[model samples]
Target: MKRSKRLILLPHCVLNQNAVVRDLAREPGSLSGLVRVCLEEGLGMIQLPCPEFTYLGAERPPMDREEYNAVAFRQHCRRLFAPVLEQVTEYLARGYRIVGLVGIAASPSCGLFTTHFRSGEGPGRGVFMEEVLAALEGEGLSLPSLDVPLGYGVDAEETTAFLARFRAFCGGHP
Candidate 1:
């Protein structure tokens, strides 16, 4: 069977900034730069579920990891991740090479290396990220994951740095 060269898991906000809560989106009603990069490189991309949006809706108040770490929130994340895990597993079984899983840095529910906590930013994975990692572990699978913040605006320096990091995470160009 034919398989895609690479698979990239992206947070929902990266594709649909308008779905984000409050004024936190960097590119409202448009795709983030990261998504554009993936498309240009022809990588198979998957937009993961947004636990926050699913639970609280688009108009919900912005919150941090501390607030989203509750049992109910965690349960919601788990539920949201189940189908995602299944899809990843199917892709792997089909011999699709998953380059990496990309998340939103400093997000309360989707961050990988940085998370929003206690009204501030901190070093840690977000609630939904935790569940995703746990599901990957349960399946005995491991893949490189990185978090790229989306609210960094369109500054040239910031965009360059983010592209560099993303390229590095993908193991060089494309």
Candidate 2:
């Protein structure tokens, strides 16, 4: 049976074992085997960049606080989101159908629902996900997002599950 080509945008962190924002570069092998696996399973994978923080934007971890700098937070968000926007645009232009975007949950910059940030008193959601979702909506791009928890933590089984869900969504083309 021939499977349709389905596009999935994966966060670089999940794909790269040695990736960190300190250098702003990733190892060449980060996406090596993963890409082949995606193709073998009928996915046209697009590896997207993820931003890392040196210190969680606070003296202490933002997960310990409740809010973050509204202005700086948005700027940081742009850093993470802009590249994804460009990648998605290019994929669609190349006739690739986007099935969904996969990101790490609990990430201040990429969390789908519960990212943490430093509030004046404690920690809270940095609102990065909300902004990304809104931006996509404004641009008329409705892409489903999968928030894979860290418990999966780069497990091969988790990756397989992710690909399966991605393929299912692409099959529906919504």
Off by over 4 Å in 1: 1-3, 172-174
For residues 1-174, could you state the per-residue lDDT of candidate 2 as single tens digits?
754646777776557645534342223445444454556657766665544442252133334213543667667766677767887777778777877876655666566755544432222232565666776786789877776554342567766666556445545321
Report the C-alpha lDDT of model 1 over 100-132, residue by residue, as the tens digit: 888888888889999998859989999999999
True lDDT of residue 157, candidate 2? 79
lDDT scores in order: 0.82, 0.57
What TM-score would each prediction reach against the true structure? 0.91, 0.61
Model 2 TM-score, 2 decimals: 0.61
Structure candidate 1, residue pairs in collision? none
lDDT value, residue 39 of candidate 2? 62
